[model samples]
Target: MKILQITPFFFPSIGGIENYVYNLSTNLSNKEHKITILTVNTENVQKEEIISEKVSVYRCSLNFRYHKGLISIEFIKRILSANDYDIYHVHIPFPLGLEIAVVASKIHKIPLVVTHHGEYTKGNVFFSLISSIYSKICRNISLKYVDWILFLTSSYSVSLRLNKKIRKKIKIIKTGVDIQRFSATNDGAILRKKYGFTANDKIVLFVGSLSIYNRYKGVDYLIRALHEIRSVNNSVKLLIVGEGKLVSELKELAKELKLEKEVIFATSVSDEELPYCYAMCDVFALPSISGPESFGIVLLEAMASGKPVIASGLPGVNDVVKDGITGYLVEPKNVKQLSQRILKIIKDVKLGKKFGRNSQRVIIEEYQWANIVEEFEELYNNAMCKNGDGGT
Candidate 1:
């Protein structure tokens, strides 16, 4: 199958949607499916680069930005000109991309599959009102035309409250993790020593972009919770892995809380070292405070690393982190509860290990990339059949 994946961001831009598109495209390419990624040139990298015999990337010139979305007229033009794809699978929250895909599907009579990552929920009052109105218009039109809509979890699909016709088009497909790369066997000793973290220190890991646009991630809440945890347990350390515009602000917050020594900021971590970062943590936390965080992919990565995890009890996130089995789930932005959950795992070694074991088991049984790719393949075939094209 020749698949064109349209997204707002890709490699060099670290985020959940970017990582999802990268993994999905690469995995499909490995199965001998031709995959072409169409994304904005946010980082001004190569315009067009072939990743493998079956995989390639084409970065469209970015025109500008409107709030959180990147606007690229070049991207829309490219989509209009292209007609050779067997599948047009676009990831959204990208309103322009979805609109163009709807147009392209009509023009070429091709199957269009949309993966709705989440809604836009990070803006002020006026912007939020505008975003809501624009989202409703775009979603109604796109849902009517798209061949299928993939969601990260059934709970998220239910949250949308789509009518019966739209619900029929929904398929629940969770984001996947590279289980082999993020296993328990990967040693974190080098990373620990590099960060001056002694064996006695219990590391609480948080990985995500620290951009102001991503304030919904609730990193400030996590920092405050760490401050609380530190009062009783001086050995507890917060290791934040990722870099963005809000890095300085987060650093200032840590300093203000007198946690300069307790908080370790790893800003220059490479892709190859991410697994080690996960391996070094005693507990992983993602305290996202809003709807934009539909699903937390980092939670899965940490779980695959055989680490106990704690995340907001948001609809999609709760589906990923089982409240009592794989890890605990606290209310979004609850600093006290977040601290208590982290302390529970850190203080009780046996419970933490049990959660870690369950975490690995869940990853092996459900969230492996190979298994996820197979699900996609099946969905693609079904989409083609529905479009009266049979199979590729």
Candidate 2:
């Protein structure tokens, strides 16, 4: 099968959707499927590169940015000209990409599978309203033409208010994690010592971008919760493991809360070292406050590292973390509850270990990338069969 994956961003650009496409493409390539990734040149890296024998990536020149989305005329042209693809698998929240994919699918008579990651949300009301209107128009049109719609969770599908007709084309396909790279055996002691954290210090980890567009991630709420937790537990330290425009603001907030010593900002963490960052933490938290955070991929990474996790009780996120079993789910933006949950895991070593064990079990049983790729392969084959192209 020759598959073309269209996404807004790819490798060297860190985010859930980028990671998902990278993993899925590579895994499919490994199975002898010719995989080509079509993405924007966000990092200004090579325009075209070969990742593996069967995998290739072509990046389009980025024209401009509109809120969270990238606009690229070259991308649309490439999609229009693209030929001989067995499947057009596009990851969305990328309105322009979806629109073009819909056109290309019709022009070429190809099967278009859209993975709706989430909706676009702006920080301000006026832009939010405009974005909502634009999204609805694109979504309705894409739904009519696309062969299938892949959602991260059933709850996320519900959040979109997809009608029965649209729901018939929907398939629930959760994101996956690399269990081998993020394993319990990975030593966290080296990372803790490098960061000047004492063995007795309780580390609370938060991993995600801090860009203005991702304000809904609620990193500020997590920082405030850390301050509340530090009021009583001095040994607790917050380790943030991502860089973005809001880094300085978050640092300033830490200083204002007198948590300069208690908060560790690891903005330069590489992909190779991410597992250690998770392993070093006593608990992982994702306190997203809105619908844009459809699913928490970092939570799965933490679970794969055998760490206890805490996330917002958002639709998609709540479905990922089993409350009180794998980890606790606190209400979005609830600082007190978030702090309490973190404190619970930090204070009770046995309970934390139990949760960590359960987390590892869940990842092994459900979220492995290898297994997830097989499901994708099956979906693609079925799509091919429906088109009378026969399964590869």
Clashes of each: 0, 0
**Which ranges in model 1 have alpha carbons more than 4 Å from their true place?**
none
In the range 55-169, model 2's lDDT, one tens digit per residue, is 8999999999867768899998999998789999999878788899988988887888989888876757876787888776767767877878999898878888666777889
In model 1, the Cα lDDT at residue 343 comes to 95
Query: Each prediction's TM-score against the native?
Result: 0.98, 0.98
Worst 10 residues of 2 by lDDT: 121-130
lDDT of 2: 0.89
lDDT (0 to 1) per candidate: 0.90, 0.89
Residues 62-159, candidate 1: write the lDDT tens digits. 98986777788899899998899889999988867889888998898889999989887657888788778777676776788899999999887788
* Top candidate (lDDT): 1
